[model samples]
Target: MYIEPSYIFLVVPAILLTMYAQSKVNTTFNKYLRVASISGYTGAEAARAILHSAGIYDVQVEMIPGQLTDHYDPRSKTLRLSSTVYNSHSIAAIGVAAHEVGHAIQHNKGYMFLTIRNTIVPVVNIGSQMAMPLIVLGLIFSSFLVNLGILLFSGIVLFQLITLPVEFNASRRAISILENEGFLAANEIGPAKKVLSAAALTYVASAAVAIANLLHLITVFGGRRDD
Candidate 1:
């Protein structure tokens, strides 16, 4: 099966858009975080406060070295924050920290999407790593292998689609906590929303690219079967 150049064209824009959205969100979040006052609370403190308020005392908030690498690890029940957010007394820092804490909340609440995502995590990891190689090799060899590749790549697309709501819900919970808990003021909500919204777009672009690539692969390989 011949790979279509059109698929490459389709994915190029999505790749660029995802990169641009990521950079924009990082820049915007950092800029606002640097300037927004947090009423004397640091990011770590804010995260702890949020977790405590949510009755999640077992989750540990740890400082990790890196920029914008913060995430919640459910396995270890650790909320890892980058150095800047871990210690900063800024709105962006609080917002980001709370966002990660939101995941812990989801875990505690038994959120269905989170559960589903966790269940598929291993499959997505393996499928994503293997799909492209399988597809390319199959295309170079035989139609049967090509069909298998497409099926594997379809799994990747499904995983990306499943990821969308999980991320968006986390952001929504973060924003709500910031507002209800008074971590962010009215003036600060706009910037926080921008940061989170921009961040969400990266996921959207990723899903779109995955779907487009899968479609392209199917078009090429499926056509061969028909012929």
Candidate 2:
């Protein structure tokens, strides 16, 4: 297998930015870790409350192990939060939990971007896993496989790009609900915003990294002129 120094140049900046985004999330979360909501609701309770307010009773709130493993599963109709978020009453925990609930709400409402993302998931997974091996084999054997591999990588990048808007909209909904419903008090909004915004930056950084990797691959291998 061939590696390109250009790959480092392309991917390093995105890696650095992703690290920065992760740091920001840790800082913001730690800053608000002790700060509880005025309503004194744990993150799991907050999710339930927000879902009820949104008239979404069908979604189940459940706990799983690990840190920041929170996510909403559309198929299972379940919202799973990390142990920290599931039981903690901290602003950071509540913010994260609410964000996942926003995803549940999106699924319930047939959110367009989410619908698109979900529809493409199986293909994207297959494409992403297939890209590198196909590219490597194409380099060694069949030129026809090269362009196909690049296209597969591009699909992954497209999926990441679509993910950005979905995540931003979820954060928007979470913040709006927290603020409007008084789960976040006037003075506490900044920390919650910082936490969610920091988390959003991580997604942005992930998309950026995917794009950077795709560009680097294209630059190195995309110039083949014959099959």
TM-score of model number 1 = 0.91
**Which candidate number maximizes lDDT?**
2
lDDT of 2 by residue, 15-120 (tens): 9999999998878887787787787889999999999999999999999998878999999999999998999999999999899999999999999999999999
Q: Which stretches of candidate 1 lie above 4 Å from their native place?
A: 1-3
lDDT of 1 by residue, 1-227 (tens): 86568677777777787888888888888787768564667899999999999999999999999978999999999999999899998877887888899899999999888988889888788887887787677767766667777787888888889888888999999999888888888787777788788778888988988988877777666545523
Candidate 2: stretches off by over 4 Å:
1-5
Assess every candidate by TM-score.
0.91, 0.95
Q: Report clashes for each candidate as comma-separated counts.
A: 0, 0
**Global Cα lDDT for candidate 1:** 0.84
